[model samples]
Target: MDLYVADRSFNKLGTVNNRTSLRWVRRYRKTGEFEIHCPATSQNIEKLQRGNVIIKPGDPEAGYISYRNLQEDNDGKELLVVKGQFLTGYLNRRIIWGTEIINGLVEVAMRTLVTKNAISPTNAERIITGLSLGTLMNYTETADYQTSYANLTDELENLSNLSEIGFRVRYDGSTKSMQFETYKGLDRTAGQSVNPRCIFSKDYNNVEKQEFTESDSSFRNVCLVGGIGEGADRKLTTVGSATGLDRFEVFSDQKSLSNVVDSVTLTDAQYQALLQGKGSEVLTQNKKICVFDSSIDKNANRKYKEDYDLGDIVTNINNKWGVRLDTRIEEIEEVYEDGNEKINVVFGDEAPTLIDKIKQLRKG
Candidate 1:
């Protein structure tokens, strides 16, 4: 695999070898990352910048992971450890502006939101640049909202969740523009016909490591959604659920209700959307089904681009272990060293975030 460095002007600076390792991670509905380790002298250190582009050729799955953070070890010889975040890191530099979007299509809403990101929220004097949105997918629902100071990633995800769709932010290594899309949206092509069961095997030669865990640590069924502020005006919408009530009671407090127009000024539809999104988020958390990490070369020759990827549903049945799992690909981590590649694939129910864990703990 070859790594290239380019300046902000998209001009090729140079390339370097003497590499140690290259690692890239892909996450569902969240930002992913990549890292490159190389031993370089002090003279070549100037080429690595915050916003500069780092391209890794030969892999379609980890198309373009950009540099986010950098570390260095220079005792006798300079060893540069370049850490990077996925394309979604672009949202870190963009913030949502307050705009009342009523009865707006999700595509339009996304486009509208991107337009607001034209100016940098932090640097009022300078404009935010280098954003090129792809074809926004059409969804069924008409999104409505009264926005506030929200991060661009959160804004996109919330809108996506409300619309009952998945969102992914990607950087086009070829186009040199930021890209956004709904999971399984038109931007993505249909997956291949390769059988998932045959794609991942547990044979001694194919499998290196495998593990599974089931936890109720982040389970939530009943969601008592409370809108902004206090008092009777601060209405509470409850998503009644009876599952797992006898084993343990799970509850969630949705502090941000989009439909409540009293204090947050969100319309009823908006509130319902938030309520629905939160409800789905909670209901899916009842059980952490199956977490599988397998290293296999079964489908290494098959097309992995649009075929097997994060968010694709796959069925796995291991009769010996009495494990039958039909789960989505949550995270795909790849490690390359010494001219050999080992891809670690994680399949499970929706992975919870730190906030999700805290919310579950608070209920207890």
Candidate 2:
């Protein structure tokens, strides 16, 4: 496949055909990345612009320019390499809320980021008109983010994960517009085609390898939530019983997770919703799966597919390995080199908690 190089201003730099390697990774609730490598020939070296951007102009979906990398091979031959994240990378350049509630924060942050001079200037406009209220709905308790500082990308991603909602960053070449969406998991009943019982084995010949892993390092049965009000009105509520102490001991303390809003009032329902969501999130992040598929080359995989994506729920039924799992595709890693391509997919569970935070605090 042919490739084109460009600058940040959308100016055409040059073209390269001797592609030695390429990788495009898509992740769930995380930033995905892409990488391209080509021979360092003088002709190609000229294409290695300082502010590199790779584009597959002729191919609509793959034509988006979104990487910057350049290097020399071991043999002293120069190479034009492009590597980085998609539009989501722009979110990493800025920090998000540290003292605001999360209910309407997403809309506000996105509105600011899409401005022409706000973050990264793009030719596309925001096409998303709304977000899934179920995914972003903060019912019970409001948060007063204290001391924590996080990038816009991460803060947004964490919000999605905490709410058990689906989040996506998509580019539409047809309209030349970018879209940010938050919704519930894929609806298999959309009347199209969703086979939750899909099998991947020698009979299918689509899967090359698969691995399953389960761990309890993050099984927190109990959750402690502290409310924001001042010294006299503040309160701490503990959820979950000590019933599973014999089986395993998993304790979660979130007393300082949020500070109360003196002016705004929160209802009992919202508090329960936040507490339930946090507990479920922790319970689901302790399992994982890895799947490998090498049938398609990297260039051919640039386009999107309907059957699977960053957050689609799929089932892997392997009788040989006694594996039957209904999980979500949390991350995807694609590697293309020397005309061969391999796709590594990670499935199951959300992300783990920050254990280091507790350790450091205790040491202090």
Candidate 3:
């Protein structure tokens, strides 16, 4: 469905948002030539003004109007909501509600409902049943708690607004890593809990290497509330030193990430993985628009430009496939003709999709 201005994370409208779904009316005509104005695009019917029906032109046989709690039927076409499944406007780290993946989804859904502008408030209690086995081991673990874990005790005292918190952990055999999920309670006096997991346990522990190795990749995400991202400019996320919202936005947008050639270091495989959209949105977006700028990685340029002529080959290939995309960026060459040579390069949006561009350029 088409996204209207009223729908989205920014102005979260009606049942989809935390606030009561705003009431919208439409005109309808009855079989006996009767007309009325009631709600639009909804399953549940509400009584208004003693059920006064105001009919108008272009009325359908049965059109549900949006009123209180409404569901956006993306499957077949839920007559009410006319857009995608209420996705957030700006990207934010996901907060984990419990150690189990499913619980996390619940906390998020509940939190979304509880926020400022949502209309329909469904009972988040069902998330209790969907709890993962990991949640049993660590009932305390939740997404919010995990984010504040390093020295969570410090936060407990100051959080008069917090009601509770949850925690849990996960253990990785290969990396010998133990992961945790934490959740923070709502309302004042919000206590926190933690969850931990032992994925390296004896039962069914032996498996293949991984998707993120020297030739693969991996990532970590956190969801925070209780004013976590409220005031900060950046989303308080980390991806190598440059923390705050910038990193969050950068990783989320493939375009911004491309400009950051000096931030986190990258390997051929890892970079390629991002290009292939195998890693987190940050890494994927980063790879989608970025390439090895010769000036920064001189040593890499040395090997590729001299020993294997890798740089030259890439240049030749890109030139062949591209329609005057940026001229090949050569580093070792002297600076006689304009230190920063203007290579005619085509970026995303203005050119082709990332996948198509990479596919076209990789032929050589």
Most accurate candidate by TM-score: 1
Cα lDDT tens digits, model 3, 1-364, are 1111221111212232111222122110001111122234332232222112221122111112222223445565333222111011111112222221111333342333222112221434322211122222223322222111111222221121122233222222233222232332222111212321111101222211111111111222321211112355322332333356433322322222231233655544343333323122223222323232222222222232132221121221122223222221211221212223221211111122465335323321
- Tell me the lDDT of candidate 3: 0.23
TM-score for each of the candidates: 0.74, 0.67, 0.16
> How large is the C-alpha RMSD of every model relative to the true structure?
5.2, 6.9, 25.3
**Better structure of 1 and 2 per TM-score:** 1
Task: Return the clash pairs for model 2, or none.
Answer: 40-78, 40-79, 69-81, 139-270, 140-270, 140-271, 228-259, 228-260
Q: Model 2 TM-score?
A: 0.67
Tens-digit lDDT string for candidate 2 (246-273)? 3333334445545344456556655545
Name the regions of candidate 2 deviating beyond 4 angstroms: 56-74, 104-149, 174-177, 183-197, 227-234, 239-242, 245-306, 350-364
Which 10-residue window of candidate 2 scores lowest in summed lDDT? Answer: 126-135
**TM-score sort, best first:** 1, 2, 3
Candidate 3: C-alpha RMSD after superposition: 25.3
The ten-residue window of minimal lDDT in model 3 covers 26-35
